[model samples]
Target: MISGSIVAIVTPMHADGSIDWEALSRLIDWHVEQGSDGIVAVGTTGESATLAMDEHKMFIKACVDQAAGRMTVIAGTGANSTSEAIELTEVAREVNADACLLVTPYYNKPTQEGLYQHFMAIADAVDIPQVLYNVPGRTACDMQNATTVRLAEHPNIVAIKDATGDVARGRELIEAVGDKLAVLSGDDATAMELMLAGGKGDISVTANVAPAAMKAMCDAAIAGDRAAAEAANAPLLMLHERLFVEANPIPVKWALAEMGMMENGIRLPMTPLSEGAQPQVREALRHAGLLK
Candidate 1:
């Protein structure tokens, strides 16, 4: 029952785009101090796509070691190839991560049956608790509520991160699988609504910059305090929308750098936040009280 704001933390990098271990340790410590319930290391926001296998393993292990049991560490152990995903999950387990966040297979776009089998195989291979990540916008594969319910039966498949941004559908999924699996929102914009509708928490991008605010909103929402949640979330609406003004991690990484939390370095294929978009992100950060 790992609930509340679980930050999909960006992997801090140097200007040359190499992993910045010192910055990463600082970021991890900051999250623990800021009251972040958990951290998702090397996930989509962490540039898992750009990181090499060795780098991915190293980052996850580093996150687990740095956190040192102060908070939950959910390693991103997903790949389009089932065997590759299994291998990553094995590494997460090896390093004693609290759980593994496995996104649906991308590009190849497997059938629902294939998706079910793919997730089940990994769950079977690794005894560690696994959280399903379904972000069709990025993965090109949508794990429907039915298919997700099917996977929820697996003991190791403990939860799902629904990024569809459909609150109605999210509610339906909550009603159907809420008893069996922990339904978490991966979409920041609609996270409050989903949480009020019985979601456990959010695997949040917004938490990257405003972890304490996100955690307060989640805590309030999970407690069924809509008024309290809304009060906490009102300031974050702009951030939820603007952080995606460019592709993820680009804007979020930039926002972090702006707050002096990290360097303004993003990898190839994911450039730095464009000059034109910089003001928009900065405004959102200011609105959230992250910047002066």
Candidate 2:
């Protein structure tokens, strides 16, 4: 199982909105050094919606190559179109990524049957392991517990990234699935509690800036040591909440730049962090001791 803190890593870009491949490598190295167990390249936090198709494939390949087997690399291949999702997943498999993370289709919301069929189609077409990403807040399409349970039966469906942030519901899914498939928390804020309740680990945005801390917390939680997990998580609570002060990757990209990890570069439709939000995010970094 690819467990522990898996960073939904940002795609570093230059001021003109071009991907900075060198910076991307640096971020990956930092994650490996910090002990982050895996990465989801070009996920929502990586601005998957903005990248061109070629860019998406190239980005995933770059992440896989840079990691060089140092950590798990999961390509974010989810799309509203089943064919498109399959193509991306193929690219992930071609690049030898450890797995693929497919989000529930957004916009044109699909029925429960549609959702099931869509995912089943991808799992059937692709031979690689797949992780279902359910973040209704972003996708506007919730894959209900029952639906997820149904999907769990597929051999190719290895895990589910439950971003609902509903600890109670997440626990229910974990209990229902048992070892049929692993359940990873997509919400950093409640990740500790969810893992304590038997969740595998977290697919985290907070891990972007605080990799080591996030990994340590995840390890402790998975070991069922509440005291160690809580101690490690206390400092990161601010980051877990504040990084979303604005739409994702905005505040988080800014936080990374603030820490000199990357430049303050984000694509359009998503702007740089607002002046008002900077102080709040900076304070979060300070609380986590990532900044002075």
Candidate 3:
């Protein structure tokens, strides 16, 4: 059970578009001290698509080295191609990541059988624990419940980061595969509702900014303390909504840069926070008490 708050951490960068390994190590230390139970490196929140292959492998290795056993490091090693995913999973194993998060194939809408086969091949390729990530909104190929249940039968496919944000469906998933696998929320906006409905924890975007609050909220909810859970999350509602005003790392990178945690640089095809959204992102940081 990968319970409690797990940050889908961002990949910090230098102004020249180089990986900022020093800041990244410091961020890892900060998250551990803030009570984040685990870290997911190079995930959607980490701006995976923008990272080159060499940088990706090095980032995962850096995270594993910096955490040094204080936190579980989940490497986001999924790819649109089956063999590519296997390649990355091999890297994950090489670095001794606690587990690997395999997102549903992106930009290629494979059939249910295709999804099953894709995951099956990766599972066969690696011996590490695996968590499936289903975010159709970004990947564009949603993993329906039936496909997910089928994949859950695999011994290596141990958990899921459900980001569909549909509570009824999430509850249905729990009812279908609850006892067999862990169900962690991936959507920060609906994290509370989904978790109360049986999710073990969250692979949270909000955790990047408010790690202690997110961890406390998860711990309280997992303990069935609804009041404490709600209280812990109240101050973060605005951040949950605003950090996403732009697509992902854009706003998150801005927030982190504003806090002096990372450089404001990002790879091509994704730019810095849109001018209009900068003030909102800044305020979200201030509202979350991350700003000076």
lDDT winner between 1 and 3, please give it.
1
Q: Model 1, 254: alpha-carbon shift in Å?
A: 0.5
Q: After superposition, how far is residue 118 of candidate 2 from its true place, in Å?
A: 0.2
**lDDT (CA) per prediction:** 0.95, 0.96, 0.91
Candidate 1 has an lDDT of 0.95
Better of 2 and 3 by TM-score: 2
- Residue-by-residue lDDT tens digits, candidate 3, 7-63: 999998887888888899889999999999999999988889989899899999999
Per-residue alpha-carbon lDDT of model 1 for 13-98, expressed as tens digits?
99999999999999999999999999999999999999999999999999999999999999999999999999999999999999
Q: Candidate 2, residues 1-292: lDDT per residue as tens digits?
A: 8688999999999999999999999999999999999999999999999999999999999999999999999999999999999999999999999999999999979999999999999999999999999999998999999999999999999999999999999999999999998999999999999999999999999999999999999999999999999999999999999999999989999999999988999899999999999999999999999998
Worst 10 residues of 3 by lDDT: 283-292
Candidate 3 RMSD to the real structure: 1.0
Please, what's the RMSD in Å of model 2?
A: 0.5
Q: After superposition, how far is residue 179 of candidate 3 from its true place, in Å?
A: 1.9
Question: Number of the top candidate by lDDT?
Answer: 2
Backbone Cα, N, C clashes tallied per candidate: 0, 0, 0
The TM-score that candidate 2 achieves is 0.99
